[model samples]
Target: MRKIACSLLLAGTLVFGMANSDVEASTHTVKNGESLWNISKSSKVSITNLKKWNNLTSDSLYPNQILQTSAKKTNSASNGISAKKGTFKTKSNVNVRSAAGTTNKVVAKVKKGTTLTVSQQKKLGNDVWFHVKVNKTSGWILSSLLTSANKSTSKSSTASQNVVDQAMKLRFIPYLFGGTTKNGFDCSGFVQYAFKQSGKKISRTTLSQFAQSKKVTSPKPGDLVFFKNTYRKGISHVGIYIGNNKFVHAGGKQSQVTSLSNSYWKSKFDSFKRL
Candidate 1:
């Protein structure tokens, strides 16, 4: 009887341990403005482990995507100096290779100002390589050619105001159908240029810009003001709001400052948004 009781107790303990282990390997829902780097840091897991557990090929994350945070009974290691995960930008045009070495085949040539989502890194002697994803393509780039995205986004408020300031300075620039230069600009092109100048990267068209941004109820200076049904149905035009019901956009034959309260504009006004 005594032997049977001992066996039962051991079985119960093992079952309880297994249940606890299952509980340890939990899931997290991705949120807006979150990265695998930040999630790993918050979850006390290595970025490598996070990717492996979640089966993520790239560092990109979207709002509400569920991810596994850990594996049962596995210790979450620290992301050491050899590996990092974050957003980076190309300093200049650079080749993304198949592997960490110069001998690897070049998979893509990324242009300057292109944004990269880095998921992993490897240090080889004096050289370090980052595993980066640009759009849907994944490859490796030399660390020296990459700059941290934080350098631009660290002062987000200032950058936002700078976008408006830059737009305000272009009041009289001529408008062209698809112009993206200082000499001429279309509505979306003007917006893209102003944001780029202020160290923010936005999409090239009004539709893409609207899709990528988050809607806001109370807009501040530098928030995006959208309009619909100006030329076509759905979201058509975009501008940078500069408070007091005013916004700056490429309109008519030139870039101009206009009022959201204006009858034509007010009728077409859509919701304000932020990137």
Candidate 2:
């Protein structure tokens, strides 16, 4: 069984390497005071590598269990080059850590309470920028702007408000793909535009948005649930499944409200969740 990491007790602290994946599940049960870094270090592995092997981002470990891990990347770096590491508190339920240098293309998703690593930064005359790496790739970001992990402040989201308002105002609007205006909209686009109206920063992709929140067995009024079986495995369409087995979504030619208990939606439904 895998042992727990003691370093995790340090209020969102982690010490891991870029590539050291020859990990074995902990043999003993994890006790109260163990940090993930301590366990990895004692086992001669790095935390990053441990995460890579086990696919873990948020920290908290248990005792007496084998961990799922993968082999370390051959080209991964290890030698400590002069680098600066900072933290970014999650403003939303799910935060994206993109390649250090891309206008688009998310590298990985960092959940709340996880410490992100930073390296050689690009400063603007004594100012910090977003020059850090998530899983791979480097990019520019305001270093000073990236809040410390210790900060407890949260980024506000009005997704629920906007969603409800849009549904009410455009109760008759049709659904279309790539349509942002009130004219027509696609499954994901409808949700995006509605949330935008409500003042929430959301992605364009449905699956990406779905990954932003944890799933729920039952949905709330403004919850954005997804459906599939018509295109992909996880989900292909989206809607705001309101209370009483009903939902509002942009589909066919107009944004329409339907029932979650309907045969078509029920069969195609994947899951409902928050963001």
Candidate 3:
């Protein structure tokens, strides 16, 4: 597997928390600030290769849009990149290293729900290594720590759990009215941020998000449960469901996990939507 440029790691603390597992194709959900060239630089896949894989005539991308990063598998790695191919979900929070071994420098820390595209599989003594791509970043992860991405039940469950795990990592980040970064977050901003970290993209504002999603009678964990008239007349707040009738959101003074059954939220409950 070719090495993706590690220089970006020095530029900032890269946070990868998205989880998607598709056996048919290796795909990436474009984030808020990503561009085609940036994706090329990170995945180490040439712009030409990316376009060919996704069948793009122009360099246009929007948040929540899923783009195929590698071609659909046809009995082998058809992308001309890896030898052995499959979509793999990280079994745990893992470090993506610059090389296949621990002696290599750490490039980024990928969260549990993070999905990887395995291009090459290598066995070095007791440690089996897989050269993989996590969103825009490509690196090596241990093979034993991955499971095939073909199980929808396991995939969704793993994804939701990973989303919760990643959200909790930012505990106590102060609430910022319009903030969407790790530094701070508003209600909707926190929801977007959490999903983005988990490798999924959603609309930025509560109203847009509420309008964009499909309403569901019952919410699954990780579904967006919005609230109306929190500070305004209509839908104004959103949070990520975390099972047990609980969700995590940026509320009051900071980001936190709270109960959906809580009197305040329960009274303001608007609807649930699956994205």
Candidate 4:
């Protein structure tokens, strides 16, 4: 009974995080005198709807914050180090919020991964974005500003929304070596656990799994790919492709998002396959 209760709790939390977390669009710059409520009225999208979409809970905006609309803005690019876990990507939005739980509404597109640190973590009605410390300057940012890269894991096949939805719930779980199920996962363990959620049971090792699945020309939403150097001499670690050129795998400590085009990854690149 205790084990069953724990399983239910974990499943419930994972579902909640995925449902409430909608990566907000990158648009409208926050002017010195502006508020989200006003923007909502102007845009014709209801405040309630906007909050629901962006995972917000208030009615304010900040200066110089770029807001994403339906409009197609040219992609912006920059570079930084890994401030926290996860590969903070090339065109993801970095959200900014205040300590008072008011909407500070500062948003920016991440050019590269920055070692830029975030301190405060506030939860108003259970929305969990971070309070980031801007790089090389004195300013604040909301955890909502960041977005996971939309890269594909493997092109063999596209996963249903349910599968992707299930996989995303484990975004922050720590990587555990030899972990192949729900208790925890290393890169390959994460792959098995996610596939299991979708009613599939995959192999436990990268080398073994790599030999299995059918190779695909391109990566799609839910596919498996392996990496070298991380585990064995040749094909070592594996990850689930999330689209674009990225996959979400449990790196050393946690399961954050990552890419295949980066230096280390590019060099260790292996074949991608659909299961």
Model 3 lDDT per residue over 1-275, tens place:
12334555533333322223334236666899899998888666789988765535467666765666664532234433336788888889999875567876676798887778887765666787888887676667878888888586677888888788878777799999889998889888888888889998888998998988889988888788899988999898988888888988899899988998799999999998888
Among these predictions, the greatest lDDT belongs to 1
lDDT of 2 by residue, 1-275 (tens): 12344445432342233122223333323456666777676666677876654434555555432333335322225211124665565444433322223343444455554455565453345554454556543334445335666343222224464567666676677666677777778778788877777767788888888888779886667888788876667678887766688888887678888887888888998888887
Score candidate 2 by lDDT. Answer: 0.60
- Report the error of model 3 at residue 189, Å: 1.1
Kindly report which residue stretches of model 1 are placed more than 4 angstroms away from their true locations once superposed. 1-154
> What TM-score number comes out for model 2?
0.42
Model 1, span 117-220: residue lDDT tens: 98878776788889888887777899999999977877776878999999998889999988899989999999999999888888999999999999999998
Off by over 4 Å in 4: 1-161
User: TM-score per candidate, in order?
Assistant: 0.45, 0.42, 0.45, 0.41
lDDT of 4 by residue, 84-129 (tens): 4332232344433333244653344344455455533444464554
Q: Return the lDDT, model 2, position 241.
A: 64
